[model samples]
Target: MKVLVTGGAGFIASWCRRELTARGHSVLVMDHQDRRHQLADGEEFFLGDVRDATAVTEAAAHVDGIIHLAAVLGTQETISNPRPSAETNILGSLNVFEASTQYDLPVVYAGVGNHAFRLVGTGCYTITKSAAEDLARMYNLYREGGRVTIVRPVNAYGPGQSVAKPYGTSKVRKIAPAFACRALTGTDIEVYGDGAQISDCVYVEDVARAFVTALEHTAVHGPTERPVEVGPLESRTVNDIARLVAEYAAKVTGREPVGIVHLPMRPGEVPNAVVKSDTTTLQQIGMTVADFVPLEDGIARTVDYYNTEWLPGYLAA
Candidate 1:
């Protein structure tokens, strides 16, 4: 299969591209920025924005399937700049669905597992992502043999995740990268709202596998109504994650554990919220919670990446 993966240079999409190739499929990557190190032999990279209907339509022309992953990320960032995020997330998704319908291609959409359910009083990221998911379902309803599948991943974290602001493009700080970087540098690990808010942190590789599995399932059997939720079985509190990162940083870098500071919750964030996955659809597609990477192992690898790769680059710059 030849697949068009929007945002293929992103953290999760990077893994998805590799997974597709490892499974003997070809990849056509479309992204606004060329963040990729180098395209593998025979892999195609198209420099285009999903917000452009012409670009999206052209990219979808010859691909057998579309894994739409392009979007303006970060809850706080989207909330601060809603229009661009909406244009990228909602309008871009509309273009993808329209092109898919025109070309009769299968689509595997990346949905937000945690925020999609928060309909009222949510941030721009949640609203736009949920709206995009609805567009996928709507496209499926009208088009015959619609192969749009939604894959919702919760708190996806891994090696390639960028540090927000001065270090990377993300406007808002992500928990894993924030904690890992702070711990590695012996800085205070900031925890918001008493650090009791729970999140289901799924490894990026596992999330990528789930996307591929959903694509394969949609290709074999038609689209399903239930969105496939991808994550690990266990949930961890924000405090737990901070402590783990500090401990791992101590072990990996031979430094003492860093202090964890408590701060007020950020805007558009809910306190004491627990986000977990419903793996029924993924199970039907032959993925179980057992296949997920262990939280400790994932965090260890993530911290090591920060220590070895990300931090050095930031410091050099």
Candidate 2:
């Protein structure tokens, strides 16, 4: 099938694009042509922004379905200052929905899950994503001919992740690498507040697969599906995650890190967002969480990626 994937160059979207191509589907990736999201040959990756409905419609014109993953991310974008974040996530989503309306295509709306639904710091991202996510479900209902599928993902991280996007995701982004970086460089890891907030992280690969599965389920169950979830089999605590990162970084990089630095937890932080889905609903549609990379492995893999990819390019001269 020909799929029009928005933001295909992003961390999770790239992983999904890889999987889609592997499965013999042609993907038209529509992104802002940022360096991070460039496309290779044999794929029709375009330099188009999701905020531009005309561009989205044209790009999605020949596609059988649409995967909308592009958005303004993070809590800082929310709590610190909000207009851009709100516009990108909420209004941007409306533009995509408009494109779907124009083309009469099935849309897999990749809405908020981690920060949007469960406990996440900051206010902007969660509020907008949640608002947009809610709107996604209401789209087709409002328009008789519209078809939309909503997928909410929680705590997704792995390769191709932006550790510097400066929102809540970035804040979360620093957590893993901060610990590993500290272990490797013998530096102090940055901690925002007390080290007791519980969170969950899904591998980028898992998130990519969930994007596909969400679309497939939308096809099988019809487009107006309410809420489809995809994430790890379970959740993890911050301390658990940090300890694993320190331990694994020590083993891999031969650097034993110090204990975590305790700070105050951010305001409005959900002490626990351990979302155990009634995945029974997902199972009915043949979508189940199969592969959940362990936190230690997630950390180890992150450390390796940072050493091999992140720090090498970004380390100051």
Candidate 3:
């Protein structure tokens, strides 16, 4: 099968594209072409924005399946600029759905699991993603030839992830790479709020497999949308994550372990929460939470990547 992957240059999407290609499928990656990232060899590329209908349609023209992963992600993007985030995530998703319906292609909608609980901090991110996810289900239900599958993935982390990106005029990093970076550099790991927020962290490779599974599954078709969930087998608290990262960084780099630096919690984000896989939906999609990568091993690999790959390039630039 020839697959079109939007946001193919991103952390998780890059892994997904790799998995798809390894399974003997031809790939066409559509991305904004960030200078910080590079496309994989032996795949077609589309340098365009998902918000443009013409661009999406043109890219979809030759693919049998579509994996819509492009969006304005990150807490700062949604919190600071809700309007553009909504425009890109919601409106841009509509363009993908329209093109999918027109071409009669199957599409897999990558969604967020955090929205299953009450969103605490800047919710525009979840708001827009939820809207787009539901739209894909709508297309599956209402349209004659639309085939849409939904996969709501929990917090994912692994190698090949950037430490930070430009947010407004400043740079901010997510918890995984940020903690790894600070630990390797002998700096305190910043913990927001009370550091009690529990989350399910899955390895990127596992999440990539889930996306590919959903894309290839044929039983998902109907007006009612049931999202297949992907997550780590177990959940860990923010403090636990920090401690583990400190330990791993110490072992890997032979540096003294760093301490935690507590900070205020961001608004619109939840606390004391755990992202668990919906086993019932996983069964529906012929998957199990047991297939997820263990937290310790996943973190170790991610930290190694940050220490060996991400940090050097980040320091040079």
Q: What lDDT score is found at residue 216 in candidate 2?
A: 69
The C-alpha lDDT values of all candidates are: 0.86, 0.68, 0.80
- Model 2 over residues 77-135: C-alpha lDDT tens digits? 35667887777778878888887777777778876655444334546777877777777
Error of 1 at 209 (Å): 0.4
Ranked by TM-score from best down, the candidates are: 1, 3, 2
What tens-digit string does per-residue lDDT give for candidate 1 at 51-132? Answer: 9999999999979999999988867667788998899999999999999888888889999977544554667888899899
Query: Estimated TM-score per prediction?
Result: 0.95, 0.86, 0.91
Highest-scoring model, TM-score: 1
Task: Report the C-alpha displacement of residue 24, candidate 2, in angstroms.
Answer: 1.0
Per-residue lDDT for 154-215 in model 3, tens only?
87788876656331122446778878888887889989888888776788898898888788
Q: Which has the better lDDT: candidate 2, or candidate 3?
A: 3
In angstroms, the error of model 2 at 34 is 4.7
Order of candidates by lDDT, top first? Answer: 1, 3, 2
